[model samples]
Structures are given as C-alpha cells and as structure tokens.
Target: MKKSPLYLSILSVFLIAAPFILTARYTQHVLIVVLLYVALGSAWNILGGFAGQLSLGHAAFFGIGAYTAAIIASKTAFSPWWALIAGPAAVLPVALLVGWICFRLRGPYFTLATIAVGEVVRLIALNWTTLTGGAVGVVIRPSLLSGTSKLPYYYVVLVIAVVTVTLCHLMSRRKLGYYLMAIREDEETAESIGIDTTSYKLRALALSAALTAMAGAFYANYFLFVDTTTVLPLALSVEIVLIAIIGGLGTVAGPVLGAVLLKLSSEIFRNEFAQANLLIYGALLVLVILFMPDGLMGGFRRLFGVGARKSQRVSA
Candidate 1:
C-alpha cells in the first residue's frame, strides 16, 4: 500500500517544529537561506530539469521580481501581499519574449542565450539609477508586525518555499510535465509523438520564470533591500542551477535536497572559516558533479532501489 498522508503530515510537523525547538538564531538564519535557494532551485528545475532547457539567465526573472516589488512598495501604499504578484507579473512578458527567441535554439546555444539575457537585465538594473537606485539599491521599510525580526522573515520564506515546492510537484505530475519530459528526452521524438514541443517549452519557461520571480519578491522583502548584484548577479543564477544539479535533476525532491545541502554547507563554511570557503565550496561541487552527475538524490535512489522497487510494486 502507498504510504499514508498521516505519516507525511507527521513528518512535516516534526520538520516545522525542529528549528524552533533548536532555538539557535544562526541555525534559523541558515535554514531561511536554505529555504530561499530551495524555492529558486525548484523553480529553475521546471525548465532545466523538466523541459531540459538550461537557462542560465534565471536571475533575470529574479531581479525583475525584486525590482517590481521594491518599486511598488517604495512608490505607493500597496500592501506587501500585492508586491508578490507585481514581481512575477512584471517578468512574465520578458520571459515569454525570451522563450520565443531562445526556445528555438537547442543545447548550449540556448544556455548561452540565457546568460546574455541575464547580463542585459543586470546591466539595466545597474544603470537605471533613477528607478533602481543604481548599484546602491533601494531599502524597504520594515513591515508592520515584528519589524526586523528574523522569525517573521523566516516564516515568510518558508511559506514561499513550501508553495514553490508544491507547485513543482504538481507540475511534474501533470500533462504539461509529461510533455516537457518528452521534449527533454528527445525533441524530435516528442514532435513525432504529436507533442507541440515548442509551445510546451514556452509554457515551461513561463511557469519557471513566474515561480522564480516569486522567490525574488520574498528575498527583497526579507533582506529589505534590492540591488543589481544581489538580485540579478550571474553567480546567483549559477547557484540556483548548482543546487538543482547537486540535488538531482528531474526529480521532485532533488532541488530541495540540493538547496539544503549546498546552502547549509556554504553558510557553515563561511561562518566557521570565512577564508578559502569559496574554494572549498567549488571543490565540493566539482567532486559531486564528477562522481554523480545525476545528483545526490539520484544516487540515493539508485543505491537503495527506491524508485525501481516502488515502480515494480505498483506494477505488481
């Protein structure tokens, strides 16, 4: 029999309470950053993992979202809730346009195109001093309740993290998910099987962009500031991809695992030994990629035969 939802609920309860129970502010902050990357990694997987579209420019959507939310909150008296929608809303058209152009290309070309797009967005954010406050960035006023409290920010990011992961799970099981997977495996074969590969890729890109934008919104609010480097940096995009890759691409839990492991390790390294942390981080990533290209989750599943056994049991 399939595992009961009750078991899953209990697990979730334990996870939610564990951090508070530990009562370590530093640990909580690390967890918050993990949640942020988890959302971003999952969102990136919608295209990179599902559709096999390697978009290195995902930070563009992220930056757009951050800027949109910042602008709305700064200029008007709009509620922070609305800022969430505003960020994703602003990036939709750009995503669609980029999808139209780059989706036509395959493999490395598409990846390069995405990198260029991210750079363009970053440049715009840097130069648009009047609007984006230039490189200095815009500071956000604290929210009404628990101003500057880490707990409130932590919960907000956690909610967005949960929502993002949930959405990715649903998408992976839906028709669109199948279509994207088909294209990922073989575009020509998918087309031969009567799938509209182009349209499906575009759809995946749109969804990925929107979801990533939402993460950006939360990041801006949580940090209470927005800058070109922080929001649209190439390193940020790479970090998201690295998390998904290290976790396990094309699996629901891969990005989550990857994000948590990578972010936690990085944080610990930075805190414990600020010097040579990046070198250590880079070395670890290289090792993971070299030994297990399919990622940590994939290796675990293979080693334990979890996926194979489950499928076999289902078939039986």
Candidate 2:
C-alpha cells in the first residue's frame, strides 16, 4: 500500500477537533488514555523495536518518573511540571545502570535481566515507606488544569504522543535508527560492520528510558496519584510490550494503533465481562498474537498489501 500523509493529516485534525466532536467526558478520558499508552508504547519501541532489545522492565523507569514528580510535588514547593524534565532526567542514571548491566547479556538473558531489575524496583517502592509511601502510594498535587477542564490534560498528553511518534520517525530516518535496526537484526554483523553495537544500544536505551519516564510523570500528575502496583507492576511492563507488538514492531504507527485497539478492547471487556475480564483479556491477546504476529499494522499492510514498491514508504 502506498503511504500517504493524507491519512495522518486527517487523523491529526480529527484528534485536535475531538473535544468539539465528542464532548462527553468519558470519551475524552478514553482517548486520553489511548494517547498516553501510545506515548508509552512508542518509548518502549525505541529499544524494543529498532534496537531489537525487548525490555520488559520499562515499568521501573515509569514508576520512578511518577514517584519523582509526585514526591517533589507533595513534599516540596516545586511544580509537578518539573517532572517533565526531572522525570526523564532522573531516569538517565537508572537507564545507564540498567543498560550497563543488561547490555552485558544478550537475547533472553537481557530480557530476563530487565524483568528482574523491574521486580526489584517494584519491591523497593512497595517497602520503602519513607520515599514512595510504601503500598499506600502517593497522591500528587494536581496539575493546574486538574479541575478546570479535561481538555487541557487531553491536549498535553496528545502533544506528548505526537512528539513521541515524531521523534521515533525522525530517529528511524537517521543513522542511529539504522544502527539500532542493524543491532537488532544481527548484533554480530552490526559490530562486524563497525557499528559499535553496545554504544548504539546504550544510546537507544537512554532515549527510550527518558521518553518512558516523561510519560510516567505525565500519568502521575494527570491522575493526581501514583502507586507501586499501578505504576511499577510487571503487568504494566508487559502491557507496554503488547501495545507495541500488537500494533506493529519497528514502525512508527504500530504503538498508536496498538494502543487504540488494546485500550478499546480492554474497556469493552471490563465493562461487558466484569466477572471474566481477565479470561477474556487473555484470550484476546492470544488471538491477536496468533493471527497478527507482526501486529495489527502489519496485518493491515498484508491485507491491503502495504509495502514499498519503490522503497518502504516513509509515510505510514
């Protein structure tokens, strides 16, 4: 299928006018969540997709970003918006440490390291009463737009989502993106070609971590709360991966599409199958993975035959 900017332009205009089109607060809420998930999924894709490093522990960076902002807002006089910078900034060192350790391993070993590290972070958040407020969680001071209108929050998150996609698109068009894909497809070959596999992977991780942290901090302030289980759970990490994978890996539109499908399915399943939501959810994931291994976007591409005739079309 030939890629065109028309679809993106239309989508952007529709989203921008969504407030006017869908006035219901509930609808706005759903869309907001979708946007947030898109950002989170895109962030994960930086490492998981292009870099070929599937990180199942992104929740650690996410939770840390949430707590850092919430804590600063609750305990100090600083604005929660500080988290936009502080969140990603704070995650830098953690990303470095994690990359240093996990990058030492390869394949499933690296994935396992991320899971273990994530679990450790979750546990610390659960037990560390002084900082993270233990299991009680932290209620962040609301952003200035809290009660004013969900519109503001909606736009803010939408911007983050757009920026995330834009950044990933730009990165994929750059040398770094090619290097990451090279590393992902074959690390040995990438290194043999003098791509500096480790260094490039680390760079990808840094960007991925910062983006994840930014999303987490936004989640905290927008919701006015943060909890270890909610923000740091292994399930959350898995969900991020699912979003990227189910939408389409190694593509910019994959995460956004995955977020929309998953979020809609989850909301519907939860409301309609209150008693067996988990069972239904599991079934849905299984079905998606079984039928669409390359993700929904990839499925669409095949169904409509979307691929580069001249080259992989830049427009998704």
Candidate 3:
C-alpha cells in the first residue's frame, strides 16, 4: 500500500518546527507529558494490539526501569543515559520469564497473572527500603540542563517519541506484525498455520516491556524523582491500557492519537474543573467505550472510507 503523502508532509513539518511552534513553557511541559504517554501507549500496543496479550502489569516494568536507572546512576556515578539502556535490558529477561510461564494460559487468566505480577513488583518497591528507598522515594538532584526548562526536555522526549513511533511503524509492516495479527485473531489457528505462537507472543511481550521500561527510565530522569505511588501504581498500568483501547487498539496511530487527546482533555479538565475533572474523565471514557470502540483514528478512517472498502472486500 502506498503511504499517505499528506500524513508524511504534516509529520515532517511538525518534526521540523515543534520547538518553535511550542513557545510557552507550560505548553512545552504538557507536550512532554503527551509525548511520553504517546510513546508508552505505542509500546503497550505491541503486546495488546498486535499479539492480543492483555497485560495489566506494564507499570511494574515501567517502575523496574525507573528504579534501576535511578539506583544505578545515583550509586555508581554512571550517566543516566547509560542507565536508560541498562534499565530496559534488565526488564527484558523478567518479561521473557513471565511470558514463558503465563503464555500457557489464555484470556482472563493470563490477564490476572499479569496484574498479580505487577502487584508483586510494586510490593517489592514499597518494602525494599535500602534498595528502592522505600516509601520515601529516591530523589535526585536536577539535571545540569535543569529539569525546570521545558524546551530541552521537550526536544529530548520528542526525539524519543519519534523513535518509538518509527519502531512501531517498522514492526507493523513486517512479518512479525502478520504473525502477531494471526495470533491475535486465533492463536490455535496461527499455530496450525506454522507460526510459533509461543515464541512470537514472548517476543511481543519482551519488546513491549522493554519499550515501556525505557519510557519509565526517561520519566525518572526527566522528573528527577521516583516513587512507587507514581511509577509502579496500578493506575498507571490502567491508564496505558485505556489509552491504547480508546485510541484504536490494533492500528498504528490509534494509541498516539488516544494519548494526545486524552492527555490534553484531562489537562484541560484539571485546569478548569479541578475537583470535577475525575468525574468528567470517567464519563468520557465510558462514552468512548460505548460508542467509539475503535477510537478517534478508527472513526476518522471509517468516516473517510479509506479502509472500509478493504474491510468489505475481506468480509465478502
């Protein structure tokens, strides 16, 4: 299929001038958060969207990355840059082990196992006082670039977001994506068709965990703080899942669009409605699930009839 010229042009323009376009410090800060969620959402989609593996333990991996980076850097004088690589590397083995154990289960049983794994990780972070700094949380001095400046952080996160999206795009166009989709549709059928369902599923989980963990490492360094409540919380995992679902689970751009819209809407609600923001957010989520299950991007595609004909062709 030919790529969309308009989409490519817009992307190029945005990448070239995002810094100039976002002049306000507050705007830049919000953009950073949006980009972070966008990356995280895309990462989650690898497993949930591509492989049909529902993981409720992503925040556990996220926290593992953050804490690993923080502790290694703080204790050994290693660059946080190095920690970013190390943190995700540390998470890969754990994700593989978990995948190996839980891939035998299907549906909700697997999902429940993931949730339990997350809780176990969170409990460890909360109780391991000497290693994780316990409930007090580890605080690092601000970066030499200073964490307060939004511009530098914005560019840094923007680069990461670009890389993340590119990786997702590449993966989605490859054989791995086809295998994942086959598994998502029917694991048994996929296996019958000569796909190594177990190994592919494990690969999906590992890649998802590694990417999410890298985001966590960046969050720790950018925010200069790591706490179990913020990093390892179950709520964080839920948010990741929500973004991916609400954006259009299986599509490449769905999670990115979902993150931007949700984050922006939530921010607006927080600023204007304050105490009532949660109510509004909850209501919005319910509405989206009920009426727009395929999400904003999905709706857009449907409205334009770009993919509808293809879908119809397949169905026919």
Candidate 4:
C-alpha cells in the first residue's frame, strides 16, 4: 500500500535531470517555484493537515527565516550558505512562542491567532527600517550561486523539497503521526485517551516551522534579496494552504502534485489569458473545491477504488 519509495525515487531522478533536459531558463524557473512550494506546502501539512491546526499565517515563520539569512549575510562576512542552519535556528524559538500562546485556543480562534501573529511580524519588518531595511529590503551582498542559469537554485530547492517530503513520509509512519492524526480526528477523545494534544501540536508546529524556514532561507539565497512584501505576505500563506488542500491534505505527494498543477497552470494562464488570468485561476480553484472537496488525490482514490484499504487502516 505504501508506494512512496518507488514514487519518490522516480521523482528524484526526474528532478535531478530536469535542468539538463529542459534547458530553458523559464522552464527551470517554474520547476524551482514548484519545488519551493512543495517544501512550503508539505511543511504546512504537518501542522494544518496532520495536526488539524489550520494556520493562515505561516508566512510569519517564512519571513523570519528569510530575514535571518538576509540579515546575517548583510552584517557578517560568513557565506550565505550558513543561513540553511541559522534561519531555522532563529525561527524555532519564535515558532515555539507563537505556538505556546496560540495553542491555548482551539479551532477558529487558534487560526485567528496565527493570522494576527503573522501580520504583527510583517508590520514589525515593514516599520523597522533599521534592521530589515524597511521597504527597500535587504540584499544579499554575496549570492550563493552567481549567474542567470538558475540551475544551481533548482538543485538547492530540490534538495529542500526532497528532505521535507521524506521527513513527512517518515513521520506519518511513526507514533507522532498517529498522535497528530488522533488529535485531528477528535481532540476530546484524544485527550480522554491520555494524549497530550497541546504537546503534540507544539511539536508538529515546531517541525513545520523549521522546514518552512528552510524554504524561506532558500528563497532569500536564490533571489539574493529579502523583504516583507516578498516573504511575509498573507497571500503566500494562503497559496501554501491551497497547494496542500488542492493536491490532497494529510498526504506526502499532495503538495508536490498541487504545486506542479497550480504553478504550471498559472504560468499557462498568464501566457494565454494575459489580463484575465487571475480571474480564471480563482474560478478554477473554486471549481476544484466544489467538485472535489477532498482534493485530487481523494478524487483519484474514489474513482479508481484504489488505496481504500490503506485509507481505512489509517483512519481507524
């Protein structure tokens, strides 16, 4: 039933050979964006899908990671590569603090708290001209991969995507994944059964935060720039959630598939529709939600009658 290993192995080969095969800068750029979203969406799934804590403000942690890398690069002589570690290190405490405060509330209240926290952080970055450079943003003095090829950036994000998804797959088969799923299904019953819902939720958030920050760090490095508008936008968070949901929530492959479909389609729409792309994109997403409420993966399963036993096993 668990065929992720074969799928991931094939995916890895395709990703590794993508730049060489595509050759076009634009195509490679799109691939990079897809991989980046794969990382972001998958990270969010840990908290939102697995733990059933929908956070609309994940951009907060993402921005923090971007800033961490940008700030360090601006101030110190250290290579920008250091941010892969520093970004997550900086984000961990802030993520824990936010979780500690917000996890006290449940359902929509918790969701609202996350949104507020994300906005507050964005405001801080916007107003604090001294550290974050205000609207001008911080530019990485020395970019990790110099040149316009985009191939290097592709591999960097691909690595992040692979690591994040692999971790998610592993976690889903472990005790933590079961606990988080239990919490998602029924918090009261989970608590009654002696599961520390808050603790597990916090752990999920922490893991999500770290992985999200890693993607943020990659974003900053690849772009050689960092700004609140670019990294801390509510729209970015919404896109992340949509990626997971449209692909299939609580599944490792969902985000990757969602990212591919969404990004490629958006690119096509932009090229073809030009002025009406956004409207069309919005309409399409609405249609997908209405017709396939459980997402593409769920639809596939229902249509083919595949993975039914696995689904029942996991649910039970």
Candidate 5:
C-alpha cells in the first residue's frame, strides 16, 4: 500500500512550519543539516541505490564542485549563485570521465575502483596548492550567510532539497530510470535486451555528480570555506552511501527518512557528548544494519505494509 496522501500532506505541512516554530539558530541549524543530508543521500541513491553502482568516489564530484565555486569566488567577481550552476557543469565532464574509466568493472571491483579514484582525487587536491589552495583551503571573500539569519539559508537548501526529490520522482517514472533498474537487477540481461548499460550508467553518474555538486556548492558557500580533507574525504563519500543504506536503497523516500533519523540523531548526540558521537554513530549503524539490513524505510514498510515501495514496480 502506498503512503496515504493525507499523511504525506501532514508531513509536508509540518516540515514547512518547522523553521518558523523553531527560532533558535542551533535548532534551525540542525534542521538545515537534516535537509542537507536529505539532498546528499538522495543524490547518492540515484547511482548507488537505483543503478546499483556503489560509488565510494562521490566526494570527488563534491570536492570538484566546492573547489570550483571556491576558486571562482576567491579569484573573480562572480556571485556565489553562479557557483550553483558552475559547480555541476564543472563536475559533469569529470564524472563522465570517471564513469568511463570505472564502469568497466563489476561488483566489488567497481566499489574498490571508486574508493581508489576518490583517494586519488583527494590527494591531488591536497597537493594542488595553486588551484585548490592545498591543505590551507579556499575561503570565500564575502559570506553568503553574511548578516543574515540562518532562516534564509535554510529556505535555500529546502528549495534545493525539494528540487532534488521532485527530479527523482519524475525520473523514476521515466525510461532512464527503468533502464537503470534493469541494469541494476541484472547487467547481462539488461545488455541482452539492447540496453546500453555503459551509457546508461554513465548518464546516471553524470546526473548524480551534478546533484552532488549542487549540494557541495551550497555547503561550501554556507561554510565559507573548502578544503581537500573536508570536501573530498573518504568519510564523506561513505556517509553518502550509508545514509542511503540506512534508509532504503532503491526507494525514493528512503534517503529522506534515513537522513532525518540518522542526521538528527547524530546532531543530538554530538551536542550532548561530542567525543562519543562517532562511537554512538558506529554502534547505531551496526545495530541497524544487523537488525534492519534493508534500512529504516524497508523495515518500516515491511512491518506496516502501507507505504510506497519500489518493489511494487512503482516510483523509486
């Protein structure tokens, strides 16, 4: 059974009112984080979940986007808003190149290739001082959030999050998404059916890179800085995949659900006990993976049997 339209409506209404209700900067910041992860997780879901291309190199795209914007902002007079578009544009070719190189392998090889590529990119960014500022990082001259409450930035991210979800929803109903699913389910079979698996996977990677770049642009502008370690870290890439896994792979609402629950919990734990956040996160992840391997959404739907499921041959 699909989620009730009324339930979804209520949830949307609540989310819309949350920023207004919670006036504190920190609380609002946490909410913003939830939205941020919602986008990040969803973006990763496109390639990793829907297409079954477990990329551990997404941070490469993310770092490219952030560095693109940061470099532009530091060297020129372009607005940060331009970074939104430029970020994705810059990463698209890079993503296509990476896909061309990495799509040759299958299964664990692909995953390992992604990890290696991500490390290579990070190392390059760390050493490329003239362009990326090396370990020193690039700082924006004027902050996007300067003289503004977190509210404006909150809405900006919310709009982007909405766009990301809407695009996923639309894509799920279309031919490209179906091709991706076919490839995911069985690549050889998909190839036998005349689907160009390599091309489709490349397309998915390109789109995923674009979306990730958008998020990276926002993150860099919001934070007013970008560094190789911070933007291109292996942990960030792993976090993207984990968020999707924790929710529900191949399900549209899975990433959102995972991001909300996981990011919120982490933030709360960090606030309460900063030093133990990783320990808590690791323990929670292990418990969840052990008990609910299908992720929070899959577990919930399995129990309740009343939500939109990707297995029903429906939207992602």
Candidate 6:
C-alpha cells in the first residue's frame, strides 16, 4: 500500500509519454488498441471474474454504446466528445434491464441468455437500416476526430483505460468486490450470510456495462466507423473474456498484462503466419489454458515461489 502511489505515478508518467516515445504510427495505433482492450477486459472482469456471471454478450452493451454515439453524431453536428459520457449513460438502463432478466438464471444458463441477448442486439443493428444504417454501417464525418494523427485517440483511450482499471482496483477492495467474489465462490453460502447476491451482481454488471460502453464509443471514434459486425461480434466478447482469464481473474493488473500479450501475439501471428494464424492463435490459447489454468499471474506466482511463501506464512 505504501508503494502504490509511487508505482502509479511512474505508470502515469510512462503512459503520458508513450505516444511521444513510440514515434512510429503503427506502434501508437497498436498501443491505443491495447489500451482499449485493457479497459474492456477490466470492465468484463467486474462481473465475469469477480461475480462469476459469465456474459457471452457484453458485445451487446459495447455495440449499443458505439451505436448511440455514432447515431447521435451522424444526426447532429455536435462534437464527438459527448460520447465519452452519453455512450455509457445510454447503456446503464439497458444493463440494469438485462441483469434483472438474466440474473434469474444460474451458471451456463445465464451465459446462454447473454449470448442470445447479444445476437438479438446484433440482428437489430443489422436490419434496422433507417436508424443504424443497417448492414451498410455508419461512417463518421471528418468533423468527428478533427485530425489524421493517432495521438488524440491514443490519449483518450489511455485515460479511459486508466480510469477503468482504477475503478476496478478500488471496487475489488471495497464491500462490493467482497460480495461479488463471495457470490463467485458460492452463491448459496453468500446468500446464507445475508449478502444480496442478485443486487451485487446487478451492480457489477452495471459498472461493467458502462465501462465497456465507453470503450465502444472510443472504438467508433478511433476507427471512424461503426457496424454490427465490427462492434457487436461474439468474437470480440470472447476476446474480452480471454483477456481477463488469460491475464488473471480477480486481479487488477491481470487484464493489462493479458491485453498486451494477446494483442501483440495476434499481431505477430498475423504477420508471420498469415495463412495459419488462426490455427496457431487457437493453439497458443489452448496451451496457456492447459498449462496455467489460473492464467499468467498464477504461473508467475508459482514460478517465483510467491504461493509457497504465502502458504508458509499462513502455516506459521
């Protein structure tokens, strides 16, 4: 706890200086995307990791946020800045509603329901030509970003990522975090102890949805476009979950590590083994899961004997 402030200050300095230090356009773009995933992964971790409610349809909330801002920007001549707030705001009620309905189920049933919700939202975006531009998608005018350089996008996403991670960190240490983790471990036990599992789950989902939505809005602005396929894909949702699970579930820094590893590895695979990239990528993920069921953090702890030391201390 004493070193936290120092570590945070260092991290902030590095993030702020990253765009200038990287210099290369492609590197900056990749960094922006990495930060985006960091935010997305952490947001998903709030519910999926801490609360144990596996949502296979978070892309629905994400797409809603992107679509909300895109539709609003396309209609009005206002600046895209409004989306930083409006996007998440639009998603809040929908998340609550979804939670209210889906929380009634347990385990895989809840997961399946989320998948259905995501597909439903995607289909709506695909067919609703008048509102969302249908399959044609909505393209942002030049007025949206105001520049060709990636620095603005980089900084915006950086801030979002930092805020999202910070919130997740804070939440994990508070009552909500404990309640959600209790739910994740054993819902009936948590309920027996007077923890309102449903209510805490809803809160986790709402927080997760808003942060995911914010990232979605950034996706629209950075990519300068939005479509059902791009914003609301099952693949995207899966990637978000993989980031959390692969990095370290229920750990604050895990998503950041996971995002970096996944994004960079995918980029490498695409460039080096263009034809067999998907195969290699899937195999790599499998290997990681098989060897390190608790993810990279667990592997690191075991390798460094951190777990052994902790056990020894507990025994002592």
Query: What lDDT tens digits, residue by residue, belong to model 3 across residues 106-184?
Result: 9899999999989999999999898889999998666655655677777777777778777777777778887898999
Clashing pairs in 6: none
Error of 1 at 204 (Å): 0.6
Candidate 2 weakest ten by summed lDDT = 307-316
TM-score of each: 0.93, 0.95, 0.94, 0.95, 0.94, 0.94
lDDT of 6: 0.88
Q: Pick the candidate with the highest lDDT.
A: 2
Q: Is candidate 1 or candidate 5 better by lDDT?
A: 5
Candidate 1 stretches with Cα past 4 Å from truth are: 1-7, 146-148, 308-316
- Tens digit per residue, CA lDDT, model 4, 201-252: 9999999999999999888888888998999999999999999999888877
Worst 10 residues of 3 by lDDT: 307-316
The C-alpha RMSD of each candidate to the native structure, in angstroms, is: 2.3, 2.4, 2.7, 2.1, 2.4, 2.8
How much does candidate 3 score in TM-score? 0.94
Candidates 3 and 4 compared: the better one by TM-score is: 4
How accurate locally, in lDDT, is each candidate? 0.85, 0.89, 0.85, 0.88, 0.87, 0.88
Question: Which digits, one per residue and each the tens of the lDDT, describe model 1 over residues 1-316?
Answer: 2554697689678667867775787777787888889999999999999899999999999999888878877788975546678888888999999998898789999999999999999998899888889988999877754364477777778888888888877777678877888899999999998999988998899889998998898887777789997899999999999999999887778999899889988988888889989998999999999887789876787777776423112222
Q: Taking the tens digit of each residue's C-alpha lDDT, what string does model 6 give over 198-311?
A: 889999999999999999988888887899889999999999999999988877777888999998889889999999988988998899899988888777778787753231
Q: In model 2, which runs have C-alpha deviations exceeding 4 angstroms?
A: 1-4, 308-316
Error of 3 at 309 (Å): 8.8
Which ranges in model 5 have alpha carbons more than 4 Å from their true place? 1-4, 143-145, 307-312
lDDT of 2 at 167: 91
Worst 10 contiguous positions by lDDT, candidate 6: 307-316
lDDT of 5 by residue, 29-107 (tens): 8988889889989999889988999999999988888888898888888877677899999998889889988999999
Q: What is the lDDT of residue 265 in candidate 1?
A: 86
